[model samples]
Target: MSYDNNSAATPGYFNANRTATVTVNEHNFNAAEVNAQITAALQGSGVAAPGLGGWSTNGDVHTASVTFSADADYTFDVDYTDLAGNAAADYTQDKFTVDKTDPEVEFFDIEDKSANNGTVAPGVKYSDVNYMESGVDITIKGAKHDKTELSGNRTNIANGESIKMEDFKHDEETDDVYTMTAVIKDKAGNETEKEVMFSVNRFGSNYIFSETTEKFLDDVYANKPKDLVVTEVNVDSLVFNGISYGLDGTKKELKAGSDYTVKQSGGEGSWKEYTYTIKKENFEKEGRYSVTIDSEDKATNKMNNKVKECNIDFVIDKTPPTVVITGIEESSYRADEREMTINLSDNTAVKCVDVIIDGKSVATYAQKEIEKAGGKISYMIEGASEPQKIEAAALDMAGNETTSEMHKVLVTSSVWIQYINNTPLLIGSILGIVLVAGGLIWFFVIRKKKEESK
Candidate 1:
């Protein structure tokens, strides 16, 4: 009879179980002669129970067991005799592995430093430890045996693994503490996982507004100044540097435009005019909100730090002031040197009244001066051509300004000349003509009578 070894007992991989099992398929089978001579051995590892078996068979079916003493590969073979008194000459051989445990992986401890000052976190007295921006260590204790392999994310593990990394800065890029995972695997493909955690702090802390920043925000009255100049904090100098704030701070390694983007205009200088804008929708019911800076997310982003924050409280005003020019008739004539009265009416207190003649500010009454005059200011017009263009701008306390449409005044050279030129000459001139005609008739009649009498 022949033994048919159909499948492998230890299929793909296994730990050091020290035993391999296989089913004995009998042909022309062995029922009574199974124990005739069953032998097994591990190749290069010497004999592992050379002849040990209590044959148990059921018509063309039997069992074979192989024992492994050490971690080694072996071509195990088994031989037996059939019930027909035939000795199987060749050995039924296959591969068997002996490993049953994972390798031991150990990791040492490491600390995260404050990015602001290049100091360790949980500092003495818990001072201003703002951000964490350094590499995390995953120092592995060197392995002892040749069967163990240690590795990190790359997984290029080697014997006696020891790796040090210094690129540990996690902020908006990920939402968890920095961790380095290293796994150690045995020759039989069993693994042991170990991780080291780090606490990376924020790079910069919130600081009280500086004088430059405060004035900039304070001057912002929603709609006060047209094309108002805005000032943006210098990230490189103050915010990210932690120079202005009372916090431990350090320079960032990530480059701007590549690693992160700040919602700003202009450059990295301190207090410069920027093009940052406040949307009209934000002022729907204004309560100290006009503008903001944000580092928006994207489908592909590389920001490794939290978006820097600024806490600013600014009030807004968006309505224009009311402007009216009164006490001046439209398209009317004046000799010269006329006092034109301008009136300002607004919900907010009137700031000023600026009388513009032909688009030039001929006279401007300031806030206190205009308020003292009950929001009415008079401006003198002289040496002005006929239909002189006149406009008035009223400013409210909130910096809202409204300039009225131009009104024309026909300033004449002389009012008396115009009056005489427009009036019909003497109604008494007709009386003069009638009286002269009567006198002439009377004289002619008298002269004619004298001539007739002569």
Candidate 2:
């Protein structure tokens, strides 16, 4: 059976098999000592020498080429030797194999922003993203960014993957300068921070403006400019009851029983003037009249009108004189006296003093008698037959009259008669008896002597 398949055997069974080549590429060495150690390891591992079917090198580098059985696992040990061909001390031979695979990153993400330490506007917030081995966790920090820190714990922050800055409130107490910061960490334990500055200011509303002064109002109302010009309607003064009226230029006076118009002197076309009338009865009754000038200028239409007030004083002597008795002397006197003197005075100047006896007027006395006697007037009472009543009436410059009370007086022919009449009856009877007795004795004696002689 074995010889029967000789002619059917696979073609080219006698052809030689291709050999498996083991080529070593150059190794990356960071230090020349490390490269020398690697070259010694290859040489001491029983590998063929360089350029002798095992490895080759230009100068300091060495390469190896070899063939191995297919589908067979092989293990070998690398022994490092020193430059003297002896075992090297403090040298490590690390085994490595090439599988052509990608390496894995333990943690990967962008680092979150860190807490900023600069100015920031109020009522604003900041945030950042972070990564970790497990997952992303956010951390937050908040504060009044526009205010100064009072305590050491003013900053509120957390340590995590991601971070978010809380919003800050802006109030009237907030300062103009502000700062905000953000801190963030990544999966690799890396941290970053950022800061920003901003400005805060207060706003205001709008309004209108106005202007006015008190001096302007006073000047407009006082009419200080119209003090000069004279008008045709002006008069020198007002007269009444024999008295002339003149003002101190502070007020205007009008004639009695006359009506007049007062203005600023231009005319009716100018500012309107005040109009008033002087009634004769008022002047006659009160002896004086007063009026005020309160006028207006209708040219400029205004809510508040211009006005002026002054006292207008007028003189009128319509009042009658008032008489008063200032002095009087004699209350009683003898009627036989040559003159009766009286002292008198009046409120006004005395014009005359009249002697009135028993309701009858005596014309013998003159005003000259009262004036020359210094207000004492004497009247002849010698011719009066009996005790009579005498009085005096005074007339003043204004024709006012005042009368004195009647005075009592006695009139007698002789002093002896008066003495006898007023004497008691006992005194008169003694004198009468003596005179009768004497007359009777003389008559009787004469008769007796004649008879005896016959």
Candidate 3:
């Protein structure tokens, strides 16, 4: 019942008493034949029982036994064979077993999803795994299904750190609207994706008011009033005076005092009335006055706030005309010629242009007629040979006079000469007379000689 400690065992055997036995009944084989067959099977097969001391066969049975000091697991193998001399089937099993365990993962804290403000500042991180211990590789990917991947594989995310998505390349064939995505990968090759939406706004600069004012001013100046003296007063008022003739024969009625209103012709074939007030103090001192006319088309009722400027210079004349000697030509001429020319002009339109010879107004020249006659006039006098001083004066429309310097001219006789001597004519006449005289003298001489001779 006891066995030595150092012993081997057969395959598929347990050491209950430090021994194992296999019995074959007579139906399978006789005891002696079975014992012989078992011995042969054990010898040929490599199977052994570690629990038995060794393999043995006796009386139609096979036994194996093994002994150990303490309870310890061992390994055993068994083989079986058929009597046809084929190799036996072997079984093998190990005494020790092990349990497969998975590695621990240190998960980081979950980060707030960064607002995809289209900028990379606040970033996001996954809290499910640590990069160092997790058997899976770490990869940050963009959820932008267009295969956009983030640069630098990062697992740790800080607060307010941005997750940058790949630059979007516009596809000509697709719509411009694009969705941004971010993907995070853990060591286990797991990935998470997030997306956000945004749009672009565009703008530039424009001028609203000042440009309009400039355009209005340009239009007003382009159609300026010609005959009227247009002067720009302050922002509110306009003053004008007629350079030629006023609406009435008298002075033109202007918006003289402040808070005065008047009607004017609009640029676009319409009459427009504008309220204007002139500062009398400014007008009296000969300062410029201006008025603003907000004109509206009578038909279309389109109001145009046009600014018209005017200046009026008024002067009162009570003094008689003062004569200033400008220039005078000679007055005394030959008896046949009876007129002398004088040059005269005045500051204002001349009313009368006259020549005075020795303070006698013999001929008066009309200003318009004189101007029509090349801006000068000649005074005709009888017996122009007599020496006299002549002066010319011009009277303006306002009775202002300007005179010319007196010029004294003395009349003298003109000498005359006539030449009658010519070479051919004189020679011919002299020759004819001499020839006639010679003939006559010859005839007389012949008669006298004939008488003497007789």
Candidate 4:
């Protein structure tokens, strides 16, 4: 019963027992950005805390997320405490990898043009489109065009680092500019597409050549011997891939064997250029003419783009030139002295004019021969005159010649005609002069008589 008070505190020397201890936040996990998952291993230790964005964790477990700060590796830090702020560590530095950019597909070479991109097999309408990368395919489609362009997702292109896509049509349909789109894809289902348009230029660049027209006259004279070829044929009726290309003023250069089927009959493909021949429209001389040159071919596009005609138009002038003489008439006598005016002109140009008097080139008429052939000729009477005949001979650049169309003028000198026109005026002037002299003399005589009477 004694020792009831013996339950006192244990004395100094023998008291030793652990009350508190230190621990760390430990967590570990791996992740990828593709799964859209945020990973955490905070259970049994650290509190799951959010990392660099797009990551969130409750006090217990981590949640999954499609959102992330960026497509790059990331780390999630988990912190822990034993009871208070005693111990802590980055529980998990989980690594996450991401890839976001689309793969690039290269097609044409920047250098070494003319190298085959691929379509170089016989009867193939296309050429090469070489590539320098892996995991890419080209599928061409002209959804807006005919079936020939609808290449349903072509994947059979020969595979290589230098992959080639052959057999792309080289010729454009008549009057139509076509578009071809290539859809490129890779192993991961990534895709890209590019479209190219081929313009219709089948008849060639040098299509039409002609002359100047001045409203009233189409100067076929400008083309001279060669002539202009003009005719209408429907160039748009060309059919390719079972579709007709309607006319729209398109001139495509011949792709020859690339566009049309080759045949052995009638001159090795009917696209022979019309051989130009020089012909004169001279039998009838002066007239308007529309000359033509045509070659037939069911296969090739015509020279001027139409299937019906390739022609030329020109005119040849062979009309005789005329000379005009103005001054005197046949057997006329004129009191006045004047020169005869001559004018010679032609459609081309006047070459020379000749003056023949009594069938001889007279020196008295300095214009016995004029290169321009017509201007004016002076006449002078030096002796008792006899009737003289005058005529003009004119020639033109086209070698056509004609004398003055009017009857020749016969000129003669006349003294009687000169007197009647001048003699009466001369006699009146002498009588006026004598009357004035008589009045002055009479005035002087009267002055002397007045002085004598004074």
Instruction: Output the worst ten-in-a-row residue range by lDDT, candidate 2.
Output: 203-212
Q: Which of candidates 2 and 4 reaches a greater lDDT?
A: 4
lDDT of 1 by residue, 1-454 (tens): 2222323223533454444454557667654554424333333444444333455566767665545544445555556576676776675565555544455444433532112213322210000011011211233221111222223233223333334343334452222223445554544555556664433323322222345555756664445322222233222322221111111122223333343233443332222112333332323443344332322121222221124344443445567777778756765454656667787777546767877887888777888887788877777777444457889877775677788877877566676543443324444556689999999999999999999999
lDDT of 3 by residue, 347-452 (tens): 3345677778798775677767867865566565444434667677777554456677777764433311001123355678789999999999999999999999
Question: lDDT of candidate 1 vs native?
Answer: 0.46
Ranking by TM-score: 1, 4, 2, 3
* Cα RMSD, each candidate: 20.4, 44.8, 37.0, 24.9
Q: Give model 4 RMSD, 1 decimal.
A: 24.9
TM-score of 2: 0.25
- Tens digit of lDDT per residue, candidate 4, span 34-119? 12223422112333323333434444443333332232333333344433334444343434322233334444421111212224
Model 1 stretches astray by more than 4 angstroms = 1-12, 15-53, 66-75, 82-85, 109-160, 166-177, 183-189, 200-454
lDDT of 1 at 45: 40
Greater-TM-score candidate between 1 and 3: 1
Off by over 4 Å in 3: 1-334, 346-348, 412-454
Against the unseen true structure, what C-alpha lDDT does each candidate score? 0.46, 0.34, 0.36, 0.36
Q: Model 4, residue 202: what's the lDDT?
A: 44
Candidate that scores best on TM-score = 1
